[model samples]
Target: MGRSPCCCHDAGVKKGPWTEEEDKALVEHIQKRGGHVGSWRGLPKAAGLNRCGKSCRLRWTNYLRPDIKRGNFSDDEERLIIALHAGLGNKWATIATHLEGRTDNEIKNYWNTHIRKKLLRMGVDPVTHQQLPPDHHLDGASASLLPEALLWAAAAARLGGLDTGALRQAQLLQHLLHTIGSNNDATNLIANLAAANSVLNSSSRIVPSHLLQDQMNMLSGTNYLQPGYLCNTTSNFTEQDVVQQQLIKDMSPGTSTFEAAGPADQHCNTTAAFAARDVAPAVDMLPVQEFAGLMEPMELQLPNLCSLESDSFWKDLLEDGYRL
Candidate 1:
């Protein structure tokens, strides 16, 4: 491993951190010596300071700079800092953009001291979107204790068991579109979403509606609509049929609405419900031919008698299928 650095590395150089005397000297030197604010690497040499350029620059910018804002932080500023951190995460540079006159270090320190505790008190897990354990305490915990990415997984579980693969593909396509600054990549995203169970079963699958609405909601940008070709096909299905199937599924927990909705939503619950409500049922209920078009064709395969042997014979014959 490499050795650690020390402020006293060089002999005959003013070592250690910048002091009040050194700060005054540097300030006076800059005021009296009228010259350009040279590159950071050359500032120490120009200012007659023995410190490294990085150290000198930091001391000047963070502590001695004229534009530096110092004093107690305000409550509104503190709340803004918390919101920025929650939304954008550990990007101090980006967070600093929202905070006027606040350095990254100062915001970082304030987060560590005050806002972090406030988040804990609000039953909000600062990192994950879950509740923190009541008995467990945070003494030596860092911000990493709450990783934000886990929120995606939690949200995925809530949003009808979203497929991780589909979500990732949708995200990548969105990012690609954003990078190229166009909507051409939207086709692939729509195809992926239409193939998923979530969109096919949603009430919004009705006409002219974007198939990738869910994905767009997740990504926060990119209004990737399903292609007009796909939407045109979906127009064959009506909104009321989709709603009824969803209501049925919501009423019946065990079954999927896909079977009830059929290939087109217009064919199922809407037509059936309407006909049953409007026309009188014959004393003899109508035969299957009345609804033959609405039903899926069933496969009829007769089992061979040879395949239906005694349980004892099959048990012995299928013994190899069992494992230890």
Candidate 2:
């Protein structure tokens, strides 16, 4: 005899987009529970939904897509999105961290059709975030050769959890300099950065106490620092620096495991080497769940919110799609 079918087949309830009456039931059920309806699977059953857990989840996340701000992108958001894409690459959900209500699909579309062309038009290589070489200067450089600046961007992405494009540009620049730049140039660059920082600090003339407090807050929050800054002289950093170091290490044949030996075995050796040297892991991708919390409207603070009258950018990020 055949075994009993799955619960879904047996249930034989209606499936797909919930009806208005069904929505009422679902909303009522949630309201009764003090507006804290937990678990989509349980929710559907409580509201007499015949749909499966996955369907319910999709409906809520996509259509209901609560806390979703439905508006055109603001200039600041556009800049942030561009900067984030530069730093993070094409990780849309991760990119969405900075733009509330903007879905991954929306951002991906914007990048492919819109933002990318705009950058390229401005002489910025979308992938490298660098300017193209002059027409005559392209003699030695292969058209396909990824820019040296992007190498540092890769290194930065490998070494830091920065956005891929920006990091790639930075990394490429760093590597190229190290490979081709004279010691004097590196020193000069560092000197310039230092000088610029000093001038900015003095000119701003912010209170030292406030500045110190800001620094303290940043160090306490989820701070992203350059790899050089994260180094500790005496500790094995493999566990901590997994994302960044792993990306760089993965690129090399030595770290890429032998075919005969399993990847697990090869990684074991790499891990041991890392432990001995006190080298930490690399930073790369962002977790979606964690990022959602950052973008969630419920958690936004009142003080950081700019007045709607004064700032359209802030307004765009917060407002839902429907006109008020």
Candidate 3:
């Protein structure tokens, strides 16, 4: 036996975009009924429109609603969309819930047209937000060595006596690059490095360690300080101070913390310069001479990257995609 269709496709019912007159009719009809249309299947007839009930409902919900916001999306909205998409996959209807004025259709279109392309260009899989496999011929061993590279960079920045702000930025770049891998293209690599370097130069002011620790504890419920950790009893030093001092001593001149010969040592400065260039619009990267004047001698501490990893959310998004 053949199943019946959900919506009737009568010859009299129109399809496609709605006209101004049809819009007015639907609006007037809803207004007369206190904005409640009892049955969408009966809406077209009651509103004096030649459209299918499904079409009419779509138009009303996506376009003619009084609170519908149109035009360009704000930065906050864009970020919300990305985060939602990351957590929800292509469940546009669910993603739309967090965006006040956006429709599911609109969000779906925007993601396909804008965000997806951007992620691809950045060598990240839009669905997983993970780095794509690199082209080994172009990137060589460096392509697969991102984690080690980042650790070395962070250690170097600390040994160089970089201020806390620069150290934090280095940590952020490390996390971002490791998560969102870059392609082998020279331009892409340069852009990534420039962005990282810019992050360091733009904010040279140090945030108090106690305040940072408090925020971290609130978010992750983990103590920054471990029990029996060596510290001066009278000194008011945070965990950051201890980490920085350790890094400096470990890397100072004759230490085995880092090898003198490696790809990391050879390319660290160039990578930083490139990252700074990529993020130049948001924050300018100061020259070495200017950086010295602006920076203050402060201890460095690595952020708890593990606490920030939303594995369950990404897993759910992947599962949702598979289900759909």
Candidate 4:
């Protein structure tokens, strides 16, 4: 049950949270008067409010003000507040002048309740807006307990209830995006990992040689070879298909890392194409089948990562700054 309201005291002044009636009286008085500035002292008496001049001023300036913004702070607003706070050093009233419709008290309360805790969790000194010393920040926490990209992945994983393996992959994917920085090749690589869940789900599906090639390309396209398109094939299972099957069969996660010669094509004698590219740093170096056809990015069936009642699940997550 709710606690009894802190009604008007012996002095006839109300305390605690202001009520609807009080707020209305304060707002109406300010609207009817030219405005409440130096007039704050007289506002309570004229407006039929039992609040003190200070209370009336605070109510009009901080809470009942017509221009005050309400609701959760936006990301831009939060960033701006942080930036302003860094320079102003707890001069919340000064900070209030810069932020549209936000009062000094509200900003101060938000800083105490929310942003300060988040910064501490991330090992940042909220007061200085700088990375805290390793010895001081949250006891044993690192200089940066939460790097932005990794933090985003971790947050998404925890909130979405992703398994440990998937969470690892998400972190790995974020790192790859930063490291590789290639166009279609890098994109295909990530799509491959995202699609791995599907392949893993259907372990008994008897994956086709071509499909295995797709996965291999996804896993390590540059270091490992990808099957080129079949040209003028004679057998139901072409030479390209047979070779790929044998390659997949021979290479497994247990296979030791080793470099292989490039292609054996008519253009550069297939085996003469550049084998010099660095092998992908995947721990499991599954060797790819070296094909004679032109090396092209395999068409992959990218999985629908997540689906929700509304727009695509991934799309919604991204829009919500889950990518942050």
Candidate 5:
């Protein structure tokens, strides 16, 4: 006899965009329960909602949660998202952590609807987040480069849990990839980065923080390093250094691993290696002038929230996709 299906769903459970009442019920229940639900599958029954557990979880995580920040992409945020995506690809959940109050779904949507299109218009491949050399054509090897879904899975498994410092450096490395392709302005930046990377990788011995800082002093002027200061080194490796060292050790043979290049030519090697994989470092062809424009903080999009006098208006606006 044929085996029974491994899973089943109840036909009685309602499925649709959550109604305001349902949203209220779920939020109220969670709040009353001290914001902890032991089992999502059991929560709907407890809250008297006729929705599936997965649906409830998704609705709360993606929308109804009080802490989720909703809005259009800020210019700085847009740039940071690109930098993160350039190195990390489409790991939206992982990327979401870097942006406080933003949800993975929101980030994913903005990237698909806005950033990806911009990159494409600029001749950058959305999947690899790399700018194609002019008139360049993809060959068999480049054409078959891994998809973002697969890349995300591999990265998730490899990363286990992320180290923010490591992630930041990886993003910077990608920025370096594309920046190197631009005009002469990046020459000094490249030189400084090469020197800094060498100091970081030179040995297990304690690297004087000043040496790395002096090498990357030019980086201070760039958008990537502008708002943030590099962490002062204690007597040991930050998580970033450990990850970098391991990355250098385990990447495929002759794969342009960071360790393979000497400081004299590290910049060239770093860019060319990942470029071959179609995920060359850096944001999409974002040149110096464009960088200057993005540096100015642009106005953020806010919800058209109505007066609090009509409490129901808020729900109506949210349902209409205007008020949230």
Candidate 6:
């Protein structure tokens, strides 16, 4: 037998947005009952609201609740959304639990209307949170350089014992770089890059890996580094060129260098470097500032290259930056 509906369809119940009078009635009813309305199904009749139980509940939770915060989301909230989304996927209700006074509907709407578009504009796949495919409009060298830069940043992060936040920031920067590289949009790109660079520069402390891993595990409900999760060398540069030119410059002089290889090959090298080096002291660490300095040369060169609009400019930048 089919189950009966919760409310009769022919009850002449009101629907859609609640009126101010309706809000007052609902508020008064709740207040009169000492703020306990009991089951929503019975409360509508008791409160003299000609509305469905579901609609009444939604209105109360989303709008009428005294604790509900209605305003633009702060930067902390935005970052929390991204981090939570990365870990929790599309569990909007679950994500809302971490954010006080924010409803799932509001979170979902904000993500769709604002954050999703921003990530897409930055050349990140909103679904996967990974870099998007190279745009066909990009010059060949430009297309390749962004991916190489990302791979390099990942490598540097792993080598430096940087926090997961640093790694996540690198991923975001990679998205921006990919967008600029593919679309050839230097105007907005430069401004965004400057802002990102400033943020990275202001934070000079090296976060301990174990503490970072613990926090990430707690937030994500998983191990920080699953088996076989290291980043691969995705650049198109030859092995010889990558190894010879891109030696860990920040490491103390006279330390042995390993030829950079695919993720699998480099895992042993990374492990060995960590095991041998005492990175407890901040001086021994490769700061993100040094990495940003490496990118400074590119900033200086972007204006001239962007003005040229020639493939040769991209080719020269890529070749010089990567020492290819």
Highest TM-score: which candidate? 5
User: Worst ten-residue run, lDDT, model 4?
Assistant: 227-236
Instruction: Determine which window of 10 residues in candidate 6 has minimal summed lDDT.
Output: 227-236
lDDT, model 6: 0.48
Error of 6 at 215 (Å): 17
**Decreasing lDDT order of the candidates:** 6, 3, 5, 4, 2, 1
Worst 10 residues of 1 by lDDT: 293-302
Model 1, runs deviating above 4 Å: 1-17, 29-36, 135-324
User: What is the C-alpha RMSD, rounded to one decimal, of candidate 4?
Assistant: 20.9
At residue 162, give the lDDT of candidate 6: 41
Name the candidate that leads on lDDT.
6
Error of 2 at 182 (Å): 25
Candidate 2 stretches greater than 4 Å from native: 1-37, 121-123, 131-191, 197-324
Writing each residue's lDDT as its tens digit, candidate 1 over 42-95 gives 666677778776777667766776656889876446644553454456666656
For all predicted structures, in order, the TM-scores are 0.39, 0.38, 0.45, 0.40, 0.50, 0.44
* Model 3 agreement with the true structure over 229-276: per-residue lDDT tens digits: 111111122223332343344333442323332343223322222223
Model 5, residue 259: distance off in Å is 36
lDDT of 4 at 102: 93
**Clashes per prediction?**
1, 33, 14, 7, 2, 0
Off by over 4 Å in 3: 1-7, 135-324
